[model samples]
Target: MSTSLGRGLACSALAIAAASTAPAEVPRVATDIAPVHGLAARVMDGLGTPDLVVTPGASPHEYAMRPSEARALQEADAVFWIGAELEPWLEESIGALATDARVVELLDVEGITTLEFREGATFEGHDHEHGDDAGHDHDHDAGDHPGHEDEAEGDHAHAEDDHADGDHGSDHAEGAAHVESQGDGAHADHAVDEDHDHAGHSHEGIDPHAWLDPGNAGIWLDVIAEELSALDPENAQTYRDNAAAGREEIAAAVADVEETLSAAGGVGFVVFHDAYHYFENRFGISAAGAISLSDASDPSPARIEEVQETIRDLGVACIYSEPQFSQSLVATVSDGTEARAAVIDPLGFELETGPGFYPALIRSIGESIAGCASS
Candidate 1:
């Protein structure tokens, strides 16, 4: 070979080696549940995948983290969770395993709307379409709490100001932002005072299932993208674009759901629990009753009777059960009754974890409720 050609070949080899090291390391993200994992995954699309701590079919209220889950946290560069109100079981694990990770308490994320848990055995006169003048009473300021969905009747707390503008990098700790209520909403003890139990931890506050509201999902996608971008700035544009695209997808999903439920204003239904309140509120529908409380404890005989009565009096078309919980309760309530029974998987237990999963989850919920209403 000629001397010049040999020198050029050596230079090309050195350039190739330098180019390989130019890309930044992808972040290791961890999430508390599948829904949140789906959101994080969207933000990190084409970058890396986030670890889901509590897999589908595993109750976040009572999950025993596997060794693999713990290891994921230990290796995580960042963590996303809805706060103790939803998954108190993961608190200690995160504290111990993901100490260095930037923890995002989504419940504390500002500008996100929230609602107080309804009180009572049955929603009865609390129908969203015909809701009486009865409103809500909340303690501990929720930064951006809106009044009764679109109306100005109810006064619930919403956490804002402290969590917006990409400011969710700090570790979530005590007094982060807790909600206390007198349970004086239109509906039982939905919002007990400052002390409640979820996996034997303090959980007196918001519904924690904010993901049900496609509006909140949009808010969360931006926050997820911001948090991921902060860690992986090299792909910041990709993260931002992914977040925007995710929001657009959610927007389309919301519009489709809104159209499906447009005429469903007064359609009454019973849920397995109160987890769907966010979804109900988003689409302007309300549950006639929930067979069990938000805690998923066995309902008292009186509560069951109340729910059954609600089903009968309102001519509730369908009773929805969740895949993660017992179907017997829904069956028991609707037995010998005309109400058709159905299932709505809140965590998208049947979904593949990815960018498309979040919108699909919301769409499934809308379809279930709308389908039941028409049935």
Candidate 2:
């Protein structure tokens, strides 16, 4: 085990020791991602700490558990994560489990409604879906919520196209051959292509990365509290109290960002990716459009043209790029728009340090936009 994993385990051990006098070994709680780690840390404050699968600065999309992390998962009394969909790689490991790992997925447990990757909602999407999935309020259906279904349909179509165009075809040649032999391969391919065009071209909605919304952060904290209490009934009060405090802190931080941004008269910015719907919705700011769709994918000429047009039309003041994304992409996009470029660290991609890290994250975003707006 690396020293970090060893320290995490040791911390868990110490947390367990400080809380319990029972002969039974302390429950080892393990978390799958950094955001989950943020919630778990609060829930476990003064109780036993949980093990985090992804380190502080790793990308969640490509995370692979180390042996020590797997061991932590194996020994864990419970495991918490954002969701299987968000972390597709963890599905096999989690699904093939032998023991009762007591997984508390915040996307499921927190009762927050989920949205697809890209949505057809707004210039900067709203936060209605990201909070309080307490009822059967699933507006994910196509006509049910105006543009939502179309956006989802668009994503579905894009996925179908990617599959048909052999983006992943070489890896699944046998499947491709079977489809081709069945005479449905070409038909399937056509259907997928049509869907992709519709979705990608419609471009009528906000990107649904709701976890970026701090208001939804409240839901996650609530879910974490419930799970911690269930796991350690003895310290349920402590867990609940700690979670309440964390919730208040995060909420206050979000409010501060809102106040700051409101005072700045709603800054107009551009982003490398359309991951700002949740953030923009809360502060009533704007990100003209993304420089790209998938962070790893390159933008086509037409897409770049659209960004240039949006920048001109919206009077975009700054183009904000994330840490892992190409700064060059932002620079290229900004060249046509005549917009200045700013860098924002999303924290899931960086080693965030301090209890005020989440707060600092939100403030940093506000400050970046505010700076551009003022300039």
Candidate 3:
């Protein structure tokens, strides 16, 4: 009887040892854009790679999902997105696919800060208020907000349709086959209805570009680790450890960017077709005025001349430009002034994608502004 009992205890010990050495399971994760992917990738660094939905060089505002992207959503255990405000197009598809996946809307992640869109070519007032959910309030509570049903609709609650991205129905029509498969009255069908309405909607709500802020990036890392942990408890500790490392990495980058931009001294004004205030606000710099008018629109010839005059008067260190607007016009505005036209991309379109991408993107913005301002 003593030997039998001893044998049983020995078998139990071996079983326990085997379980301890088994490989940990990680969730199959999917993320919306490069920055979000980079953050999520940090948490799942050794466990697995999170799939990115919005590939680089592609416009999130008016993107059409490919078949592989749809497959990634359908098979994913979790999906991370910036929320409807940034990729208003992906809403419906997420709802239709990614059915069982846990979707983490980073914008709605508790403690994440949001900024409202700055209107006009020249953001006149240059308001720096952080709204609950940017300028456009979305319930993401789907159904009634047929307006928010334009894009992907996987696992997100979706809320009210953000009229902010009015409609880019045409851009999705030619190649959105995967999206077109989402049943009879899917959002893709509605998008086709707004073929020419892209210019019709005024994008006044929240600026969904929250990832630009390294502080926000750090906040996102913790939440990402938490959610991924819940889905894959076996790797919870690894996820947490990765997040801690990511936060430290982000802190280090923020300090470096601060050091670089400490002397920028404001280039008098910033002309942004899209918004860069998240970066500006993070670094304690602000644009005095915009190159547009009261609303966020292209300036009339008179408005352009007025901006040029201001550039001349201030001898603005540099006049910034984005691809959304005309380069020729920017050159004309800087023609007689000492202000040099410098391009600053908010999307980090040129940066490599990976765990290090977010920090690199943040530093690049600081370098661009500081370099241009000083030169």
Candidate 4:
């Protein structure tokens, strides 16, 4: 070949090699909760870290989007959240703020099993939909405690303002009615009204804490991998491989948790809120009840008495508090009883934030329950 022709061939060959080895473009991701972020982070391992909107120790129910977080959502290539029910505050804002971002509501995703909110369970009676009721009074000073910065201290004041004028009440009632209609027709009307009277409450419907279940997390791992791979097909195999490996790690962690809990035996306990039904149901452990129905509202004196009575009646082993909220209520209830008070960070607030956080969070919960129950 002539010199110019050979030079052209050499340049083309070099270009082809460079193109083949080039790294895939990583997408900017935003997750609503820490646990979900942890799952997505695992799928995005070796790619990029997903930004977390709700910071550590913050309750999703009452979390306000900071300007930085709002920008993160707006700039994200994809935004992942549990659903409108879990973070009703984010329902309207996400549309406006992250208009161009692909919003993935994980609860709506397939292959994942969901648990319903149990009646009379911990934090079961309070309505999350009606905003904060002035009559319901439970002291929330625990949020101001050191190291618990993001607890829902002033959430009630802004709860009503969080949504558009027409977004909450009627829509919530309609959704609740839909849920009731799905049930047997006999109690549909009563159940619908009772359940959806408050737009944000989820007392009689699907529990949003699905990530508490390791099996559910495993399912989510696949979904996250699929979504990420779709966004960046060049690294599709890497995403799938990471998900597979993450699934194994989660499975092993879950197995270890199960064994530990088994050795500790079943311990009937009480949680600060009703967030752990998924975890409890998944592990076959039972919670006697919750301190409040929603973290933003305090349990009434009557409600506290009722829960204390349950603890006494059931001989519950432990009363578990969350890191995001004050343990005062747990302390008060356990004062006259033999039940031990313990802490469990459902959102992985106490653990390092990342892909490993989910498994660590799950393991910590099991360990806490086992410790309190066994002791």
Per-residue C-alpha lDDT of model 1 across residues 295-325, encoded as one tens digit per residue: 4367777888888887888888888898766
RMSD of 2: 13.3
* TM-score of candidate 2 against the unseen true structure: 0.69
lDDT of 3 by residue, 112-190 (tens): 5577766544544565654344453334443211112222111110011111111223333334433544432212212
lDDT minimum window of 10 residues, candidate 2? 153-162
Arrange candidates by TM-score, descending: 1, 4, 3, 2
Expressed as tens digits, the lDDT of each residue in 181-253 for candidate 2 is 2222112111122124321222323233445666555555655566656666777777667666776777677
Candidate 4 stretches greater than 4 Å from native: 1-21, 121-201
Ranking by lDDT: 1, 4, 3, 2
TM-score pick, better of 1 and 2: 1
| Reference-based TM-score of each model | 0.78, 0.69, 0.73, 0.75
Model 1 lDDT on a 0 to 1 scale? 0.68
Clashes of 2: 3
Q: Top model by TM-score, which number?
A: 1
Query: How far is 223's C-alpha from truth in model 1 (Å)?
Result: 1.1
Per-residue lDDT value at 90 in model 3: 76
**Highest lDDT, which number?**
1
